[model samples]
Target: MKPKPPTHITVFAKADGAAPTYWECPSCGFLSGDARFLDTEHPCPECGAVGVERRRFPSDRVRRLDERIRSYQKQGDGEIVVILVMTLLETILEDILDRMMDAHGGDLPLRRMIMDSQRSIGVRIGKLFPALAGEEFEEAAAELGYRDFPKHWRTMREARNAFIHDSPFGGPRERLDARMGEDAMVLLDQAYRLFVLLNNRFVADGHTRS
Candidate 1:
């Protein structure tokens, strides 16, 4: 019998204290933080695509923001961390959706019009992303080993909303703590990898356009 695949993958950090290091399979758009997966003979878990070359995500802005968020977290500024991370996550999601729209033949002006109309993250993830990617965002994320991402993201968003807005019902039911802030950080790291995989799948290879 073939040896069992590794259950846990390692995410390596950069020497410059930049973004965490990960690998991308060009052939199948699979993303992995595990260094073992970078071997030339290793096959992509999702598509059986083989390659040794690993690609890095071009995310200078995201990385800079992530560093700042980390600093806030270290200082025990939970509220700031949560707020900033939520904003960052939304921006990243918007970028991915925009790229997906572009791959599906949307021009610059058309893409702007479309995005302007769907400012709600729920609608974007549930309806727009699926319409462009040919799969539900949650399903795609789960397939790529981020099964809890959608739920966690929604929870954080709800918390952020509650904290930001004073409702007559309760005037903000939940308070964001350091734990939640740490969770937000975890999600931030995962988002970069997931979005990169998504871009490679739909945008980089010209799959949707073709």
Candidate 2:
């Protein structure tokens, strides 16, 4: 039987202002922001190809959106920070998953159709990732040493939804506080690392090794 997904809660540490930096393998397009990844002249873990030049992951467009989020955060607009943070996280998730699918030989139109049909974040985590990755999202996260990430992300998503959409039962969340904004920042920092690990493992290594 498959192991159950983790149900434990997560706590966040204070986040710094700087964003994480990641390097990509030009040969296979694997991305990793972990310092350990860039520390030496290791062969590209994906295609086993040595590289001449590498591009930065989380491209310029993404960096600009991250800047906007930081600006909102600095201005103490917690509500907007929470919302835009979710947007940025979702974008990263979509980008990595698309790359994973591409590595698995999915064509563009098919990938777009799949993404369109399963637009909900819940489905993406619970169903879509597993379908491609051959394991639960929670399982993958735990193995990658971020056991609490999925739980914390789910909580933040709940908070974001409460604030963005009216609930027939509870109306809507009045506002997202600075504490929640702080939590969002913590998750934002973790996202780059977690998704990079995932991309490196599943999108690149998983595909190439198999």
TM-score of each predicted structure versus truth: 0.73, 0.84
Candidate 2 local lDDT, 85-185, one digit each (tens) = 89899999999889878878889999999999999988998999998888899999999789999999999998899888999987899889998898898
Tell me the spans in candidate 2 whose CA falls farther than 4 Å from its real position: 1-16, 34-42
lDDT of 1 by residue, 55-164 (tens): 65446677788789889988999999999999998998998888767656679999999999999999999999888777788888887678898999999998999899
Considering only N, C-alpha and C atoms within 3 Å, which residue pairs clash in candidate 2? Answer: none
Give me the displacement of residue 207 in model 1, in angstroms. 4.3
> Among all windows of ten consecutive residues in candidate 2, which has the lowest summed lDDT?
5-14
- The local distance difference test score of model 2 is 0.78
Candidate 1: segments with Cα more than 4 A from true spot: 1-17, 21-58, 207-209
What 10-residue stretch in candidate 1 is worst by lDDT? 1-10
Which candidate achieves the best TM-score against the true structure?
2
